[model samples]
Target: MEINIPKGGITITKLLLRICSILIIIALVTSVDGSKGNSASPEESITILFTHDLHDNFLPFEVRRNQGKYTVGGYARLYSAIKEQREKDPDAVLVDAGDFAMGTLFQTIYASDSPGLRMMGQMGYDATTLGNHEFDFRARGLAASLRAAKDSGDAIPKIVATNTIFPTDDEGKIPANLQALKEAMDHYEVKDYLIVERKGIRIGILGLMGEEAASNAPMSGVTFDDAIESAKSTAATLKNDEDVDLVIALSHSGTSDEKSKSEDELIAQKVPDIDVIISGHSHTMLKEPILVGNTIIGSSGEYGEHLGVLNISLDVNKKWKVNEYKLIVIDDTLPLDPTTSETIEKYKQLIQEKYLRHFDMEFDEVLAYSPFDFTPFSEIGIELKEEPLGNLIGDSFIHTVRELEGNDYEPIAAAVMPYGNIRDSFGKGDITVSNVFNVNSLGIGPDEISGYPLLNIYLTGKELKTVAEVDASITPIMDEVQLYVAGLSYTLNTNRFIFNKVTDVRLQDFDGTKEEIDDHKLYRVVAGLYSAQMLPYVNEKSFGILSIVPKTKEGTPVTNFEDQIIYMNGNQEVKEWYAIANYLKSFDKIDGVPQIPVYYEQMKNRKVVEHNSNLFAVLKSPNRIIVTAYAILLAFVGIVVLIITLIVKRRRRKK
Candidate 1:
């Protein structure tokens, strides 16, 4: 120690001690920073299981009458799949894209009380967006559904549609009922967006309603803003202000494989920050998630047939990227989770019992049907070529209109039924009364046009040709123009220009005999309301050759054709139509008539041309108001009963 007492020994010792002190301080600072980083790391990862466009398919295994096989899909099965995925990851998020409240009779029944949403809540859905069909009953129906979801207890899904604005009265004041509805929405927990946190990751989910919803459904008091603008605003808020790590848009609009303007695509392009877009409305099945820059778009096919699963991973920095994505075809191969299945079954029974009590009938009676079969055709089938279902629907519509008019005006020709509008079909067999109701279940009210008696008019052959041409020329136009017709016969030369395809125009009366037609003459026609809008073409046409009578036989004005026809077809009836189509097509001959071409070439495009006897019968009959009213009233009663029962049950639960 004495040896260390060299020159400046104490000073050197002091310097060494100071250097050690600095090193210790640095070490302490580094350890504290490390601890902070560890603490700041995201707590846990989450997987989101999403489904959309489930059009009220609560049971699986649709029996294929002709093939004698079973198709898989049902709420019970879907519930099981969701539960299994959730259990696998306790933090899994479940969501629905939209179009969850219409399509099947089940939906019509549950629309008012939202049995579907209640069931979804029980199944643990985090959020849901409003589809166009959500407004099928207009504001009243949507309000009721929001109410049901709130009363169910589990946080009701955030009813997020940024673009939809509630309208004010003439005095520029919000109506009391509407204000109450808004308050109910607030009380019931239906929000525009929801920030869900799991394992320390904040996920922002917003909803979008399709533009088509505003036009197709009765959104009289609500206005829908531009999709892109709404999306950008919502995304900006979530990302900048909320500081959300991931943003998901549940869009009711759809993306097509073909070249088309999609709301989802536009939203992605305009609002680039969104991480994922779960879409529906068009009911398209994306083979894989579509990658549009940083956004991943996915949609599960409609009717509960598919479950969309997306797996994502977040980095230590809290940035997210899609790790895996797939649309799982929900079938029997996948094991069904017991807990979810039990819950689904419980709800199913409850719904069934409630419906029965409301309807004063048994569950089986509600589902009972005769072995009737008819072919159902889509809009494409009618527009591109002659479809049996189209012909039948057109005929039924014309006959109904004529009967309502007291048989004053005989419809010379009918137009092709607009493709997407015809929702059901007629089948062969006993054709029970229920089947009739099912065939016409969409409850569009009666119209009161100004000019003529309410004669629902269909475009003539030349008019159809013109409309078709317009439909083809306008790239972004909707399919609403292509009209379905009945009691008319004409040749379509797809090779010709618009209005030129229709040649050899003649009327095929009820007796199947041809009647003369004057190209300039206007005859009373019957068609859907969507078709009536195109009637304006009569005024705008180059020829100025046609005029719409706009009156029924009873001299009533035809204001709203779509509203006039109520109760299209029930789900079972629709299935029956397909079954009949398949069955008839299978036979080499029916009623000694050779099976018509199920597939035909028109304008170089292949089309399905099938026929059904039941449809033919409906078309042949004169439309009687009494008959139509009875059918509609019966269907309405059924739907009302089901809805009331669900509402009462929900109220009881809340109490």
Candidate 2:
């Protein structure tokens, strides 16, 4: 066959044969191994059911805009599904990726008592990782959850967080509770990866959380490590050391669209060892798992609204491979296990009866009326641009400060507020007392900076322009400054481009006096502490720091800096403080109505007669009642004294 071959032809032929032989040998070995691995395979199958970001939204189906009939994702349904899956395959393992706490009102209440984790443990969760919200209560709350889970005595899901670390004490010793918690977690929890052996296949599961969540979270004592680095290190250990059939990452990172960057996608790309990524945090529902090389990524929407199921098959060598995966919508049509349903109902009832009783009395009362329905977009209207809602909040802060510090002190200036901070609106109707709670749902404390009585200052018209322009240019670094002032009003000249769009600056007095602003004059202000620290306009200027005040009007110290108290008192209630603005608007009124083109425009032409006052009727109503009661008591005493005096004088004269 090589009769006319070149000088090196024989050598080349020999080399080719050797290569072929090696390839054939490798193939034969692989086939044999695969066959041997499958020879002992049983007829029964194993399944793994997983979920994440079940933010305690345990209610039934509710449709939202853009997202179609989302009738899935409650613990009851998830419980039923898991039970059914377990019935089908007794070796089923259920796991949550994280974020099982802190979203709805239910979570807030349950977190106070560590009921969510306890119930999850009772429901047979194999293991769980810490999400950002798990640390919402910071070290103390997290410790409590861990303790409660441990106390449950059921096969509690091994709580695992490889990146979270505690600070060392003076002697470099971790706190006793933290040490005990870590030990308990290491003993009862899986610190790195868990290997679940079903039938003949071995599956390894690892947990990861987003780094950004730690910074954004209200947690103070704990810190998160670099996610990518931690993942890479964990993967290396699991693959090289643990030697499992397949690797899965339960990631609390996020999903992405074309415009958004996803940490999960990045993790998959950068760390190739991860076979499947069940992700949460971004609350994206992937129609199907995205395949990147040998790995697959999937996510269910936030709240217990969707269930993600991954079906995998193993080859003869016990090597795990994804067969198919889907996100199942949990609804009534799907079969629910009675046992799981009963368990969920019991917990729900226990939670309602034991913990949430105060919600009715404290959070559900009507406080005032709104003339129009309010939504996020309402802020765009000329009349609604400066939200009456925000103005009402600002007014409440002023009043709370005044009551705390007494009547003599006047607020100088206020800091800017963020648009995102405005959560809900006071729609036109009977504004329930709960509306105030909903609007100011942030549980911020009473401190001056991080607390409610934040000293926020407004810039001069020229300075406002400068601040606004700066905010626009450096969007990333700029603080989200979108504050609405109570006594002050102004207009934005969108046509004329300047630093900020403010025009026609004027000073407004609480006593109904109006005066033109001198650009050089400085003013005092008050606002929430976080806004004051983060907003560039306030921090950049030399506005003197007024005395710090408590966030609450009831003389409560600012303990929870994250909670904000909103009041639903009407705009007319704040009008007294805005006397200057009202007076100025009087000159421009067409028919006893302010001629300001927009609500925000009116804010530009106004000034602060009183920077922060506790005049918000919603907050002051209780105080006023007490004051009236005291006055009545004093009057009765005075009348008795007059009668006693007459009687004593007459008796003495007769004697």
Candidate 3:
């Protein structure tokens, strides 16, 4: 073999050695990438558990999903889920981004019992923020609720309201109601921010309220500093002064599909030191954590439907590295905590005695039996079309008002309901008092009760048409403002100009008769007190282009809304929720239980939408608003053309 050695054998041997060297290098590189290699184990692991927009769902509530009623949330299930998470990491930091109150019958005693707060305390929430709904009963109610929570001597979570402001009077003193709120805050030891140690990691948490949240709480009497500014200040202090390992923002600011409106995301982008953001208020369910720079934004959705779990570990680089993030669904599959269930039952009893008894009702009294499910509460305002639940509520309003007024009843030309006010929907099967209250469970009446009282307001037919226009135009931009009506119907042209979307406006009777609306004739309109109060806000929202001033029957401009609240049965305030119960009871009964009629199962053409791209159709009925808009556009174009011509002539002269 040595005598017959092949030519270039030495060169081949060198090439083989080089190839083997490259393979060994590649294997070494692969091994380094696959395993920890020289890097040390994570210094420490941190677990963060969070929930947002709990919304007083202390019991497992049924929600309509995929044409089925699925049980979701409840403190018992939530507590069990929390306990499970704790078992995995006992030192997990638990917190909530607020709106924890004002959704169910539990909120009926929010001021007196503080059921939401006390329950959160029981559930072991380390910290929580205040959402707009916390002030739904106004500043006085919030103050009272805080005092009640403090008085309960329960393990209440630390409340961190970073931007809450108490405005002062000309005498440099806070108003009595706001002063009381301040005192309550001081008593509760509510701070702008709080710090805690979790398994040797110092965590700083700050609460913030968005501008829209502040605006929603107009009657709160307490204002808020700018959310971004507040977050920046708090985050800087926590990082630079407190020297915390992690900074979490419990923000009621919320996230939106629209970037400009996404408050929490904006905060994360602006505040670099904030490591995590628990966003609330818009009830957004962010299935996956949003990573912005080094910050992580998480949302667990509304009504305690899910619990957010975020896990991270400190790497050798001394920076926190995300390990995993998930939203644990609080469904029926989760075991219920017996103690929490018993506590919830006790709260139910308290609600029955303190609130439900006044209405001559039990907490679970069946108001009606629904053979079919109405629109799910989550889907109520998603689209601009007429909602069956809205029609039911609207018709219920008219019926209750008529029955209450009796012989003194004036013809109600329309009963309008804002989508924002329609909180929940009627699930199929037995509808209870709690269900009805949840549907109409928004505001407190002038009587300092839980429900918003019905009120009668007058509007010109022109304003009624404007209301239709608002529903057609503004609703596309603001779903919460979408108007649902009974005793009125109209066709909206999608192609029409802004503030001129309604192609036809008419009055429709429940008997299916359509009548022409006299532009100057005053029409009697019935709405919730909160809805009535929001009427004038249309002018402001529309930038004064569209106007809707709710007037008195005598054609005087109404000032105080409480004065217009409708009363019945010898001073018994007519609540919007009671109207639904009464209407359901009035329906034909089968086997002694009122049945929701099939008539409500279908839309009664309360709103007819027309999709047209025809230019002629769009311009057919140009209102004063459209004409003014056209004139402004023409002027702008003319000015631009004149400037261009001037510039061209000057350049030619220079040439």
TM-score per prediction, in order, is: 0.68, 0.62, 0.89
Q: Write the per-residue lDDT of candidate 3 for residues 53-103, one digit (tens) a residue.
A: 888988888877666678898889999999999999999989999899988
- Which stretches of model 3 miss by more than 4 angstroms? 1-41, 169-172, 627-655
Better of 1 and 2 by lDDT: 1
Worst 10 residues of 3 by lDDT: 32-41
Q: lDDT per residue, candidate 1, 426-538, as tens digits?
A: 43333322333334334322221100111244344454334433433221244444444455555544443333234344666645677766545455564444446545654
Index of the highest-lDDT prediction: 3
As for lDDT, the candidate ahead, 2 or 3, is 3
By lDDT, the better pick of 1 and 3 is: 3
Clashing pairs in 3: none
What is the lDDT, from 0 to 100, of the residue 445 in candidate 3?
A: 89
Error of 2 at 567 (Å): 14
